[model samples]
Target: MINTRKKLITYLRKRDGIKPSLQATLVNIRCKLPDVVIFGGMVRDFGLGVRHFSSDIDMVTTASAEQIRHALAGLNPVMNKFGGFRFRENGRLFDIWSLQDTWAIREGHAQAKYLSDLCRTTFFNLDAVIFDVHALKVRARHGYDEDLQRRVLDINLEANPNPRQMAIRAVRMAIQKDLQLAPALVEYVLEQLYGTSLNLTYQSYVRQLHDHTGRTPESAFRFEPQLKIW
Candidate 1:
């Protein structure tokens, strides 16, 4: 695990990779106050050895939201509805928040009381990985490593903000990443496809897919039938 973490940090610290000031700012705040950890897409994508990962970074800490706001006051941080302080520095978006305010854990949609627990609550297995920017360590859920190895698109948690919307995301991920949809994920997508798909209009579904993934409806639909892996 340490070796994998080192690889991840090495990539992030590379000359053309993650901006040095971005990491330095987050780590410095974490050092002065309570521990701050980096997780979500940034860790997930780069941990898989993706060099052109997205620019958004997500972080959580034991510090209070107010303290975090003060720590990042220089960036002109704005608190979002999710109780996270949002700032843009070096042309990258950073979301830093108190762990107590994580929407899933706070709303009972998922459970995690510590830094390690944070990775287990994500909607997708591929995203359920974390790096403690301060501790210089990494942690992942049970199937996390294998999912990355195999490039399989699947769910880690069923109850999320929008399961129907995620069905589209699963298809987009499978197509975009060239991943196979796991049986359980196929099962969930099928249930949502035939079951609650009526909850959303066909145009809305197509629009959402395009907006969320930048893939046209034709691209998503062409890959839709592949979900029938049985």
Candidate 2:
């Protein structure tokens, strides 16, 4: 784990290299909040060396909303409905929030009381990872390291409110990372594959997302699964 953690830092530095703006923003947050840490997908990307450039990142701090607003006043952070503050740096979104207001914890899907607890609230195994920006350390739960190593997607939580988005993101990650879907994940995606009040098929929506994001490699578009109709 120690070696893997070191490798994550190494990858972030060498591959897609961290941007100066992001570095400065993190430093500023640490200086003000002290308890802030970067968590979720960014950590997963760094650990697996999957990037061509740095972009948006999610961070969590134990500070109160007023404190966070005051601390980030220079950035003019805009509060999202979920209580997260968003500000742009070099055109990249910085999603910082109080640890106490994480959607999973606030919605009673998970419980957390510290920075590390943030790792337990992700929707996918690969995303259940956190990076301690100040200490340069990594922590994770829900088979994050194992699944990331094997390049598989598995469910970390199944009771979330956005299964449709979850299913779409699962497909996108499988394409972007060349991952195989765990049975549980596959079942969930199959169940939520179609959107409500729309005639779009799963493949169509995925294609649209692929085109819009332009992040998934063209070669990875090989997911043509056969369904077993009941």
Candidate 3:
């Protein structure tokens, strides 16, 4: 596994646009909410050494939504149904989720336990990897770092797995990270797409395809580079 502290610092240093603002924001949040940790796409892309212009950052904290809102009062955060707060600063979006109010607890999949347990229950693939700002350490479930190094796409099937969402995200990540899906994983995603009746509309898929490829929806779906099953 990579040294989480060094890699995180390096990642932040590389982002000249948001580094100073992000550092200041993190310091302020940590001062008030000592248990908040950064995670999700930012850390994932950092680990993979992929550079992309991202406007949002995701974090989880032990503090309540109200506490977080109060702590970040200057930003004027708005609370959402998912028990998270969204705010913008310097043209960047910050999404902070209360650890006590995650969907896993509401859905009865897991209890509100340790940060490690919460990290394990996160989304499938490399997105589950988390960076604890306080400890300056990385928390990843089994095979997470290996998947990152290998550029393989696999889902955490045991923890409230949403195949449809995973399938879409997998395609996006594959394109973003220049990754290839494992044979079995590709087969599984295809099965999930063909077998289940997902609420995701055809128009959504068309939009996503168009976003990824500049071609018309018909041509995009027919020959999208990201969906090439390896």
Candidate 4:
């Protein structure tokens, strides 16, 4: 578990290194995809004040499945430097789940099923948002998720970056051993992930959180560091 925790932190630090550029690239993709919705860790991290590069960029869109399929088709070859790419589209419901190693794609619905499904597929973390080309509004959706809100609040105290709360959320999720109860351990996980050197006040809060959660520090940060490209 300690080894897992260390690997997770290193992965996050690297992912944080790539977020801004990747975000801009996706925003550019929005010009082509239109009605694309992106939501995930990237969104959560930006909210928390952690300025770092992110690798896995997840997104949700209002467009139909066909539209999503088409957009992903375009992303191929062009985004090769970052890594490889793969995608899944459900035309019946107009949804998509795309992946490129550490990153993932979740579109169509915002329900627990889609979110949980995408969450289970990755190793590091994810960041997503929705872009409405028609309306020209690149909306931030994390403010609406209770779990995400709590995670962002906890991480932002130390790692919040400009408009990158989504990224922090992904990191928080990575620290969470159980998705269903993620909100319950946001404080403890963030402390274990970031330490008091980053935010002194948050130290006591993490201890209190451990008492409330009844989970050992090892449990809070136990994620196997596996980044499978497919």
Candidate 5:
């Protein structure tokens, strides 16, 4: 497991060939938002030893949306409702979101009195890791490395989870990483599939898969049987 921040950074640099432009952007964003961290898929893939040819990076900062926009003035950022700004650099899309903003938008989260509180709520799986840009460190909450190593999909029950989103993600991760959902998580997913209106429709799930991978839904679903989502 990648235990240190320095090792994680070096691994990413070597594995992703993180371009100079991307590094400069990270440095620039950090100048304005001192607490900015990179999170989500890029970090997960890195931990799992999976390499992507074109990865979309996700970042979160303690800075407000306006502050982030001012920090990234020349990037032509498109503001998103979720306290995020999206922009393209060297043909890759990068999303930067505000920590407080994301916390506010979600329901049932404890008041985020500290950054650590927000970080805990932001992640789903153990692989939902973060990279501290300023400190040059890779950090994961408890259970992160263990879950990654076990290839288990253990959902964060404390966090407000979207059932449909989780179901879709479970399938994608199962296919991409050959992971198995923990039995409890499997029950939760099935409950969400039948018991909740928040479950993602077949069409919506397919669309999401297409948007991320450009693969047809049929191809994506081919892995569903292997996932044993029954």
Candidate 6:
């Protein structure tokens, strides 16, 4: 297995592709926001790869439904006008979705309790970070902290999806980010949750998605890369 720490460093190198300092700074300033966290793909990167990058990152903060709506009031002059937080600049999109801690916690824990084939995630795009205003600390939620409490909190939070659904979404995103190139991880998750392989149709769709989203032609064509044959 790849040393998780090494993979994390690699991801950091690639994540430099897009400068997120502005967003990071904004999040830092908005630390007072309740249960505020920088989650999604960026955060997922820490658990999965050493170097990764993504244009979009999702931020989840602990605020009342109303408070979240108010905090993200000014996403973009027009985006706000359109009643959404999706903004596109230079052909890339950024999204900010805030959820109350109650909602987030209702869904699941923020850290992984154990690294089983089911709960363990070994692929990501862009390292994810959490700026906890309450704690007054910015932590690498997915990196090689080597400490259980620090590294595994809860699985990524989702509004209306279960672990299986989230795993599929994560696999797709990882392919898009070029962080993982095999089906093993996906199968691992499926087995853990579903106790079987993905149905033919689902498998085909995943393959197609990977073909279009993965790093290279070969990587997409061959789910099992030479380096990570399983």
Tell me the number of clashing residue pairs for each predicted model.
0, 0, 0, 58, 1, 22
TM-score of each: 0.77, 0.78, 0.75, 0.36, 0.73, 0.42
Q: Kindly list the per-residue Cα lDDT of model 6 for residues 1-230, writing each as its tens digit.
A: 13443443344334235655444444443754555444434544544442545456445553454555555455431233222245553344554443423223334534342111111222231233443334433455333343222322223222333556656655555444344433444444444434336755446545544444444433223233332321
After the best TM-score superposition of candidate 3, give how far the Cα of residue 15 lies from its true spot, in angstroms.
Answer: 7.2
Minimum summed lDDT over a 10-residue window in model 6 is located at 113-122
- lDDT measured at residue 76 in model 5 versus the true structure, 0 to 100: 90
Computed on alpha carbons, the lDDT of every model, listed in order, comes to 0.69, 0.71, 0.66, 0.37, 0.62, 0.41
Ranking of candidates on TM-score, top first? 2, 1, 3, 5, 6, 4
lDDT for each residue of candidate 4 in 38-116, tens digit (9 for 90 to 100): 3445444544345452345455444444555566674442323323334322111122333322232332222233322
For all the candidates, what are their Cα RMSDs to the real structure? 7.1, 7.3, 7.3, 14.7, 8.0, 10.3
Task: Report the error of model 5 at residue 22, Å.
Answer: 2.4
Model 1: how far residue 12 lies from native, Å: 2.8
Model 1 per-residue lDDT tens digits across residues 131-218: 8887778888986777777777677877787788888777666666566666667666665664334433433433343343443322
Q: Please identify model 3 stretches exceeding 4 Å from their true place.
A: 13-19, 157-163, 195-230
Model 3 whole-model lDDT (C-alpha atoms):
0.66
Instruction: Report the CA-based lDDT of candidate 5 relative to the real structure.
Output: 0.62
Residues 126-196 of candidate 3 have per-residue lDDT tens digits of 67777787877888777887777777766554445466776766656665567765545455455456544
Q: Which ranges of candidate 2 are over 4 A from the true structure?
A: 1-4, 7-21, 194-230
Error of 3 at 209 (Å): 17
Worst 10 residues of 1 by lDDT: 214-223
- Which scores greater on lDDT, model 2 or model 6? 2
lDDT of 2 by residue, 49-139 (tens): 7544366788898898788999999888999877799998656788998888888888888888888887778888888888887888888
Query: Residue 216 in candidate 1 has what lDDT?
Result: 36
lDDT of 2 at 158: 73
Highest TM-score against the true fold, candidate? 2
